[model samples]
Target: MDLLFKVYPNLNVEEVATETYLQERSILSARNDDVATLNELAINQFPGELHEYLAADKAIEDDQPIKNRGNIGCPIMLLRNLQPRDGLCNGTRLMVIQFATRVIEAKILNGSHVGNYVFIPRITLQPSVSETPFQMARRQFPVRLAFAMTINKSQGQSVKYVGIDLRNHVFSHGQLYVALSRCTSSNRISVLLGNEDDDKTTNVVYPEVLL
Candidate 1:
């Protein structure tokens, strides 16, 4: 949040607070107690808002990741293929230097354009997911903070160093391989594994998808 204040200086990033669940997860009090007890034993549990939101019936109806509150000096990833020569191509990492209602001023953090400040314009965007009803179109700068990213988004790009958290496992084919291949060599990559109880803590591949 400090980054947001440093960049915008005036804009407020209202905390998306946790709301109460509309319905109970279980009718039995014993089951509720059991869940509460288990949660006490869990590490790094999901955020309360996220837990309730995912449990809601229409979670996907308004499901767009929060983007408008980016802080200044925070690293951002370009979401559209733009100005490759200027090093503003999709998946390129940059730093937010200025934020505006309509335009964004950022400095390229990686590649040939490193240390270069550039202006980004708003563009029309549509969610490609079939489940997104209404097919709404939004005009906004196509960018997301680069503090975290999906392996799919990092594909076709190379980095000097890379980190892979395999705690959640690969939900699709080739994700593990794509993540490992992002850096120049094994020496440049670091993998984070989960404990034995984490069922999703394994590298996965789907040969059929590659075929």
Candidate 2:
């Protein structure tokens, strides 16, 4: 993922001036790295969480659960089902697995979805293609997306405000640049652990990449 981010530096919004922060609050309030907070939010709202314990009759009430779209809260589980579709010579089903830490794993589940799954190979570092334990599960059901994290699809996209995990190892020069520069001004950006010293090696880099 680091290599991919480096190669496509322009894909992520690096200029804060372009973002729109609809919610005006401390950026930490967003808690981009708090896995516990995200789990709480998901369990509180998702259909399967604690519903059975709350008023059995009310819980059984026939009502469509609200669908989550747009910027999903962190620590989300994305499940994608891979099915073949006629379009590509190599029938590959599309499956994208993205981690909260911004690592992504994409694979071709079946030949039909090959076209849809091509984006991953084109943009990111390719993971080894093979049948594994995950394939066994995929064979039984349609697997779309899964997993949870503090940051969701919002990481590289333009946003009004952003919360970043500044743990030294996670804060690479490119990451710091991307996270801090997402907001328009310094005031618009907030770091949870701002006191830590920046790693000198990661902090200093070739200036040309910044361009």
Candidate 3:
């Protein structure tokens, strides 16, 4: 996508390994699926062989086909709070440095522990009963590709260049503002509003909230 190239112009170059390059850019979208799509696209452009990690999902009669794919030098976000005191909190971002069968080696890219290498082991995860129709357990690394993340997930992250995929209108109040503000400079933000002729995006603002 043109948006991907504009926001991460060095993804296909040697600068991809630089800390500044890895941390200063990101793509945000309203939908999780759209975010995943953009993440895959960006990683595909990254210079490395594809490595796939399959999830072991178990449920009464249902199975979740969850798979994660990435390679060394790709950015990933922590899905669970493994160690908050050490800065391994949920939503912390890191770049993959090495991968083994049972664990992964990554360098922290955010927060107080930025630049520290840490080992992440695969962990068992269960969805809350109310969140799923059937009780399920999934065993997999608690990380996801971070080239792109949902607008809600991008809440605390600030980046230099941001590409917002607005093909799907933001569904929550302040979602548009969150995505737009993630970028340090207004001129460094690019947005795709679905159609070539569309120029406006819906922003949900309640007058009472402003008051």
Candidate 4:
């Protein structure tokens, strides 16, 4: 929590909507659940009327409903390649501008389409699961809150202020390096470790793979 505040202070300030302001900062974490929790906390602190959108989910075999959600004024990442030519590809970051029953209005934060406003409509997405017997499809605006994102998702994005949640030690090769390098300056990067007594965290390395 303290890490989040250190990275993104003054959420209510008018600069929150500026493209440069949103583009220059982000929080990185190793786990999806941790990222979601941090994103939720940051959204709740943002100055905006809360708007919620429920996804229409269905099991491909049984038409069963699965619940997913989104909100307005929240920073989000495109989950699918909506349009590559326009730069609305997967991992593109954007800020929600408006919400309707079936579409979301957002401004592109980075990439060639930066500052461009676009409308995102609901789309059907099916996950490939070899272990599960039944396949499920979710029809929703293809985005997820991104105030805090997984270290994997943070790849290819450069930010000025980066906060890394390292309470759960990194378990993949180069995960720590990726998180640390996202920031342009070492001094601008802040990491949260398990305890004050230790400033160390695991960085998984395969010795044979290196040699």
Compare the candidates by lDDT and give the number of the best one: 3
The sequence of per-residue lDDT tens digits that candidate 2 reaches over residues 1-211 is: 2221221222233231111112111122223345444334423432221211111111223422222221221122223322223322221222333322223344333223322323221111112574543311111111112112323323433434344444433433344555555555665554544345553323435578769
Clash count for each candidate, listed in order shown = 3, 29, 0, 0
lDDT of 3 by residue, 113-165 (tens): 99999988999998666566677899999999998999998998899989999
lDDT of 1 by residue, 123-207 (tens): 7776678574456556667775454466676676666555555544566666677777777767745555457634445556667
All candidates in order of TM-score, best leading:
3, 4, 1, 2
Better of 2 and 4 by lDDT: 4
lDDT of 3: 0.88
TM per candidate: 0.56, 0.33, 0.92, 0.90
| Deviation from truth (RMSD, Å), model 1 | 13.7
* Alpha-carbon deviation at 188 in model 4, angstroms: 0.8
How much lDDT does each candidate structure score? Answer: 0.51, 0.30, 0.88, 0.83
Over the stretch 93-146, how does candidate 4's per-residue lDDT look in tens digits?
Answer: 998888888888899998888989998888998776656776677777788888
- To one decimal, what is the Cα RMSD in angstroms of model 4 from the true structure? 2.1
Q: Tell me the spans in candidate 2 whose CA falls farther than 4 Å from its real position.
A: 1-128, 131-134, 139-156, 171-173, 194-211
Residue 133 in candidate 2 has what lDDT? 33
Off by over 4 Å in 4: 14-17, 60-71, 130-132
